[model samples]
Target: MALCEIVNKIAACGLDCSRCADYENGEIKKLSRRLQGLLKGYERLALIKAKTNPAFEGFKDFQELLNIFAGASCGGCSSQNVKCPIDCHAKTCHKEKKVDFCFQCDEYPCERQFEGKMRERWMERNNRMREIGVERYYEEQSKMPRY
Candidate 1:
């Protein structure tokens, strides 16, 4: 696909939907399914194993992480069924200003934009997008290792 087409997956808040854990065709979904099966198969065995191995004590935590990963898969912000407040707000703001992306706004990195870890990550991404431009930014994001 063209770089612009790939980069167009970027949400208004600067998050690269293509790189998201829940993004279509991403590894997280496959990993989540595998982990679910493993967890189910190992449930009783893990408890027994934990009695002798301290390492097995983290099985509960691993299960929690598995749940998180399972829930991370998304069809991107543009999915009609999903209601993402951040993306919604960003879209509204950009539309009001008649700008294409958040980076195009005059108050690009305003304090109001930084809220939680997700927003913070997007903010950093926005900075990178500004530094490298969309195509290069997409290339760079695509190169990063996914969980």
Candidate 2:
């Protein structure tokens, strides 16, 4: 992949923004909408079955969860107009350094922006990108799940 494309698809923290479940029109959104369509009349069936099967009582909760997933939508962190809606420090740091990714900066593993499992994942991804280069990293990350 080209540098421009890679920058657009990948986040400064090494996440593949395009593959994220919350990204606009992403796989999870599409799947959730499809599943919602398939279960259009499931509430009625669930209500009828609830009297007999106690497990069916949780239909509303399940539906709520599905609705949340179905509503997932984000413009991605790379969007110039709304970069990193959450105001991630890493994004600001990268812009200041004029680097497209964390791996490109001199302080590659600054350990300032993330914590716990996220910090670990961030380090691992940036290291991998540094070792293999962004193009190959983008190709590899494209095949992986965001969540």
Candidate 3:
């Protein structure tokens, strides 16, 4: 695929779908799975150490969190496997309007699927995409932390 096509995982709300924790095979899930593997035998160690150290008592909760992260999988905004935690209106709006990104829409900053810091981010990202184009915007965002 072309670089543009490959990184076309940008969401309608200007978020990078690949950077989402729920993204299938994304970095968060991959690292969580690897860490689970590395800590395979740590359960027994935690059990033994829990008798001597109270801090080790939280191992069960830690394991639960790790499992959640490791099991996380979603196919992005456009996919059927969309597991968005929020009540996202951007995706539906995009589909109805047939726009690839919010920046491409007639009403870019409409009140939908964004609030507080996310609203700010949406405006900034869309404006950046408008100024530099989606490909360049994606390149610039690729070098920064998602959150």
TM-score quality measure for candidate 2: 0.79
Give the alpha carbon lDDT tens digit for every residue of 71-130 in model 2. 876766666533345446676788888888888889877867787777887889989998
Residue 88 displacement (Å), model 1? 8.6
Candidate lDDT values, in order: 0.68, 0.80, 0.82
lDDT of 1 by residue, 19-110 (tens): 66666544676788677986687878888999999899898898888877676646555443333434346745666776656787898876
Give one digit per residue, the lDDT tens place, for model 3 in 7-105.
Answer: 347887777888888888689999989999999989899999999999999999999999998888888886667887766688779889888788888
Clashing pairs in 1: 22-73, 22-74
* Ten contiguous residues minimizing lDDT sum, candidate 1: 78-87
Judge candidate 2 at residue 100 and give its lDDT: 84
**For residue 47, what is the lDDT in candidate 1?**
88
Ranking by TM-score: 3, 2, 1
**TM-scores for the candidates:** 0.63, 0.79, 0.86
Relative to the true structure, candidate 1 has a C-alpha RMSD (angstroms) of: 4.2
lDDT for model 2, please.
0.80
Which candidate number would show the highest TM-score if scored against the true structure?
A: 3
Error of 3 at 112 (Å): 3.6
Q: Is candidate 2 or candidate 3 better by TM-score?
A: 3
**Residue 38 lDDT, candidate 2, scale 0-100:** 98
